[model samples]
Target chain A: MLVLTEGLVELNVEAKDAEDAIRKAGQLLVNEGLAEARYIDAMVKGFQDIGPYIVVAPNIAFPHARPEAGVIEKGVSIIRLSEPVKFGHPTNDPITLVCALCGVDSKSHIEMLQALATLLRDEDKLKTIMNPEASKQDVLAII
Target chain B: MKIVTVCGMGFGTSLMLLLEIQSIAKGHGFEVNGEAVDLGSAKGMSCDLMVASSEISSELVDEPVEVISINNLLDRNEIEQKVMPAIQKLSKKG
Candidate 1:
């Protein structure tokens, strides 16, 4: 079943940097009772400890920690930026979309990741969602 | 054949890529043994192929493993296009 809801969708969000974007996206998972505050902290730290390699696609990023980080439940949340923020990806930069994924184990994360990846393939859908005019139905169409 | 998916940390995107590689490999009429590894560990692990994003993939150019670097890690079409021909070559050899 899909964990993303109208509640988990945030359109035209403001974030100062990649760390802010990661925290904001992770917080949405926490708000929905799927993750903890510590998970959010770990996410920002994960990027800092590792690098900006999480920017999986052009203008898109999936900010997440391991299943053991603080996943209360399996879930996905999204934040569409009002203004693009750089995640320091070498090529795919100025990210406008951030998705946070939390899963209890590797098994569950695969299905969710597949779904997210499918959505990302549609550049038109992503562009539509990035618009300030997008509605709950619009974002839900893909998520 | 064995394939490894790599990321900064193994538990997240790399594992996701491993699952996709497994599924895609099946479609190509071959069974692949898959593992997920961090970029640091992937350098030492022996694998038929290493799939990762452009940034991580570029860093491992000097490694002996064949690299399938994708501009968009989530795009299966891109993944298949870049990876299958190489895997086909390996399959023929095996």
Candidate 2:
């Protein structure tokens, strides 16, 4: 996969649920002309049912929908929260990292998941990405 | 031996926890196999014990396997303190 990294970083994001997070991130993608704006809402709802499964790390969350959920192109958007957002899971502390991913199918999505897993495994790299002062270039550099 | 770690997503916290368990098991001279599985899909997995998030453990009560609930998935000390005993107990059974 080409790993879409251009203009994928949002300095601040507001979200109440996995759907909200993905919608916010998808807006960024659409604004940058990377994907269609009309598909954003459907993508958000498509992942809502499996949304609760997104509590990846203590302060990190990855919200993704199924491949068939209006995904015209495979892409990723990284959003850092100014303040943490709760997803109703006790084990998950408020989240800072909100990664929105869209793919063509399960196999393609798993590749993105593996890439995300690799990035999240690095504590120092994650801390840098979560930093408010960090630029989009800095986030892209790490990924 | 098979060990499975459970969390909200099979890809993130559970995978990290499984890595920790694998390292600890290796140090103890145990050749164990481990994987991270989402709570929804862990039903038929052959695992000696299920190390799961507290939320997941509550949902998995009826399973025959034992469940060890973990508070912070990244806290190595906390995981060792809580999970080591469960592993030892299962070892005795084996």
Candidate 3:
């Protein structure tokens, strides 16, 4: 099961820009031994190469790279920025919630996304989690 | 009908799009053969319609398939609004 543990969640983080936000989220996965240090760079470069398509919704940016970029395990790190940052997306810019995803393979990646998508469907729960005052324990209960 | 969801790496965002497309198609009472592919793989593939983020969708302008560019991938309402009509039209022609 994909669970967002205490180690995987950050709240009210201050980031200068989109790259800084992505790095903060990716760093959580690295600290948990879920991915290599290179994974962070790969994700940042992916944004530059691919554009901000990862800004999947209003105020939400899902940053990720290929597994070969160095995913040691299946993990996701969720970070809520203290201030929203622009990602150059047409409409979904000024992102506040950053989800850095890493998976071992195809099946696991989709599985993790499926779970995340379901959780995201709950607007009330998402609001609670997005609140800067929300604790990691509160997030753990929802995800 | 066949549809393709595309993103840069094909593992993350495209897959999320594929799932939403599948569910949306199912909810609309029609079945679609949906697959997710990277931008490189998508060019050579044959499909009736292609859904991708606006950024990646711009690169597909030269392709033969009908391209639908979406701002949000996870918003089902947006997906249904933009994609379902085309799907329904295709269903009627078929």
* Candidate 3 Cα errors over 4 Å, as ranges: none
All candidates: TM-score: 0.91, 0.71, 0.94
Task: Quickly count the clashes in candidate 3.
Answer: 0
Model 1, position B70: C-alpha lDDT score: 77
Clash pairs, model 2 backbone: none
Segments of candidate 2 deviating more than 4 angstroms: A1-4, A16-18, A26-51, A68-75, A103-111, B7-24, B34-38, B41-46, B71-84
Ranking by lDDT: 3, 1, 2
Candidate 1 TM-score, C-alpha based: 0.91
Checking candidate 1 for backbone clashes, the offending pairs are none
Q: Tens digit of lDDT per residue, candidate 3, span B7-87?
A: 888877787797788888899898889888989899968889999888788889999879999886767899999999999
- Give the per-residue lDDT digits (tens) of candidate 1, residues B1-94: 8898889888778877777778887898878888898988888788888888787888789878798887788778888888888889998989
Full-model lDDT for every candidate: 0.85, 0.70, 0.88
Candidate 3: residue A39 Cα off by (Å) = 1.0
Scored by TM-score, the top model is 3
Candidate 3 lDDT at A70 equals: 97
Fnat across every predicted model, in order: 0.67, 0.24, 0.69
Q: What is the lDDT of residue A75 in candidate 3?
A: 90
- Ordered from best to worst DockQ, the candidate numbers read 3, 1, 2
